[model samples]
Target chain A: MSSITSSKKHPLFWVLLLIITVVTLFPIYWISVTSLKSPVEVISSRPTMLPQAPTLENYVSVVKSGFFRNMFNSLLVAVSATLLSLTLSTLASYALVRHNFPYRGNSLFLVWVLVVKILPPVVLAIPLYSVFIKMGLLNSRLGLIFVYQVYTLPYCIWMIFGFLKALPETFEEAAMIDGAGRFYILTRIVLPLARTGIIATSIFSVIAAWDEFLFALLFIRTPSLQTLPLVIVNYIGEYETLWGELMGIGLLTTLPVLFFSSYVYKYYTQGFSVSLK
Target chain B: MTQNKYQKSCFFYLILLPAVLVMLWLTIYPVLNVFTLSFFKYNYLSDEKVFVGLGNYIKLLKENLFMEAFRNTLVFSVLATAGEVILGIALALLFYGHFRGKKSFMIIAIFPMMVSSMVICAVWKTLYHYDIGLINFLLRETGAQPVGWLIDQSKALFSVVIIDVWQWTPFAFIMMQAAMGSIPEEIFEAAQIDGASYMKTVFSITMPILSDQIMLLIMLRTIDTFKLFGKVYALTQGGPGNSTETLSYYIYREGFSYFNLGKASTASIFVLLVVAGISFIYIGKILKKD
Candidate 1:
């Protein structure tokens, strides 16, 4: 009786695990499979579970449709914004962590940062539209990069602040005693120790900017300047969707993020854990 | 020495000044600008601006489309957050102990969350297609009638919610699993030795210990789901008669599509108040912990 019960429980566990694994991953599998199918097979009444004659035609066509230009736009904006936000946030968070400001300024600043993080992006976008127009930043890559700071800056500050707070002050204090200047100590001692956190924060920031759509849609008018997401949406037109090409662009756009995310999977999970605390 | 100390403080502020200035321009000034814009009759295209104190707000309140959008946003937020958190706890429990292929399985499990949401939505959009979709194809295989997943008004919002739950459950699971790892194994071992059933141990021992983490997860997911725009825009475009229209999407259409900055600003203010109320509760809890 005991053996039978144990045997019954084991298979149930495996079955449940298999169910979840399939449910969680099936869309990704379907996307890849659909992307490989020819346009005729993609929209057929009887959808092929596997492309009978798998081809790279969808990818070719999508690329021919100026996919690379959009991808380049996305890459440029994401990278530039990530670098800018990371630099600003690292300096600010370091100051917040290491120095005392008057009137409980550190805590007040942190509270404000948290509010900015929580506020919906659309709230800011409404006003920012006019602001950008006045500044002549409309329809420019530089404008998009600057606007993205609204999302990335507060996040980088908080994540980096957590990491800086966790580091022991002894190392920095000793460096100060040795007459090392503050900038020298910061460059030599603090940054290296917080390298993991900084890398993790930057990767997440890049992903956020890369995926940003609402701002890009509103700001960029020129077909040449639009980002990957805008192009992906264009594939799903009001009249007809180019499913094969849509999936092709979708998979292509995701590959870079997937590669980077897997590389930092450990830190990604750790970042969430840190945020929880 | 005091002069040197003062100089060092000045250096700190100097390094911090740039971020402070950008944030002030980006967040503070825009927020105030949005508030002032909400009171006007403004149109970007024609460059018309007239002060209509609270007229935009009153119009939005009476607008059925706006009301429907509000209701849909509430429903979507509640359902998506609840689904993600619950499924997350279950996944965490299922994968609690060590097993063969655990690392690979965990990595695969989290892949959905890492991918761009647009890509995820595009994939699901194909799968949710009424006639040609894989989901409908399967239903026919089992001799079940096909359901309109995204096209049906009753099912559109729920379809969007399912995609959100699919993508984000891993996030909640990762968080829950991390918190679970912190629990000493000895406690579970003690419970087992005391003849506690698995269900009993989970409910009594594990849950009480995990309540705080669970609360934090709910707040985080709530704040995120409240800002649901990209998914709706990509999938339904809040279609099939406004079933999936969210506040963010509503604002996007009003502000961008119609160029009605006045209406958009008013809707944005409504979203801001609700979000502020929610975040205040969350911040209050997080601050108390500190």
Candidate 2:
């Protein structure tokens, strides 16, 4: 036990930690380096660990290929999905936690939500395609946001459910005794107390919506309507892969998520613990 | 007062209505639609639909490609989940106690999982390239023959699995570390005071205590990996003779690429059943706790 506690002081431990860190981060480093290399250097038989002559030509080419439009599409869809799902789940989970429904409706709803979360999106995408086509939602950003609820809504419900359940009911009860209405109590007291959980849930919702590929691939037909992931995949063609441009866009797609996760790293991990519980 | 209580209850239900309606429209309606669609021989482009009466299911059962995709999905899910959880446990144990730079180390370590799977796959695809890949470059530097990572049928699935493991192992590590943090330090101290060796203490005390969290982690990983689509779509595209074909990819091709909506619907039903079954067990466990 003493030895286990003291192991951090040993050189072998630090060496092992450093090696694991490098292996984990090597892909990000490689993409950054690859994205900086010129096209001719990108295809060299001997890959350079470092760019021989660093250039932003690949970034410029990617931008010229309409990367920014796709990025804006991704941002629009992700933000809307996050906001929509967050609002819906917060209200629903609050109701489920504070007020009981007959016939185990609350638990049954949660069970169904979990099932939707677990099932592959492809399963739902098949039928949703037909419905969207009929509704004239194909190639529309609003449809993506609606369909994204399948991913984001269930998650928000679960994460918020966990947070709301952990909150003490006494505050709400006291507020009610003071003639505060349910809506006012939820907005002022409960929501403020669960601020960390809401932020964490919103972060995850944005990430899931941003990274979504299959539904966007299926529903969105117009090239201009395509999201970032759709554009990133287009760079990898059968006959020729634009390695530098692909890596360039790949790095760009990763930056927002990396920034969010690192910014609130503590709440990010806390979100995981809450959901797992 | 009685009317006020009734209104209060109505308000709760009112707030719950939107989520219920959205879920019903999205999940319940679509699932039912898939079931109905599975009974027909339909092609979207042709605008033709004929009642098939389980014909699609029969065809999928006998089709080699569908079976291969099923098997590959299972193998990928099992192998990736096992690899991640095992490696995750090891990393958790290694970094158990307080150390300088732990916060930064953890943030960097989890970078793989935070990034989009498409981006991660792009990086790995380049690294797995036969001629100009960094892995092969290192192999050549070490006087070893260059291997066909994505081109070879036999090794292609494993290569994809390696990418999955590399990208997701940190998730398992985080889960395991959080679980480990919850265990009381006094237990380990008690084991030490009783003259138990480090390995013995870990096996006896820590393993038994963390068994529940471990099971939960495994189930979570298994469910996620079973939907393995983005990695295969980006890396192999079910390439080199259907070596890495997965259920989701198969459904995608049938539904979209080929426009065989009936067959795709049947495949979707199959996936839905399996995923639902697994998640029910998980849900039962979770709800039981509540």
* lDDT measured at residue A145 in model 1 versus the true structure, 0 to 100: 97
* lDDT accuracy of residue B210 in candidate 1: 96
Tens digits of lDDT, candidate 2, B96-208 = 87899988998898899888988888888899899888899999999999999999999999999899899889888888887887788878878788898989988998899
Clashing pairs in 1: none
lDDT (0-100) at residue A82 of candidate 2? Answer: 94
lDDT of 1 at A111: 88
Query: What value does the lDDT take at residue B6 in candidate 1?
Result: 92
Q: Judged by TM-score, which candidate is best?
A: 2
lDDT of 1 by residue, A7-126 (tens): 233666788889999998888888899889988898898888799999999999988989999999999999999999999999999999989999998888888889888988988897
Candidate achieving the largest DockQ: 2
TM-score of chain B of each: 0.97, 0.97
Best by lDDT: 2
Candidate 1 residues lying further than 4 Å off, grouped into runs, are A1-9, A261-264, A268-272
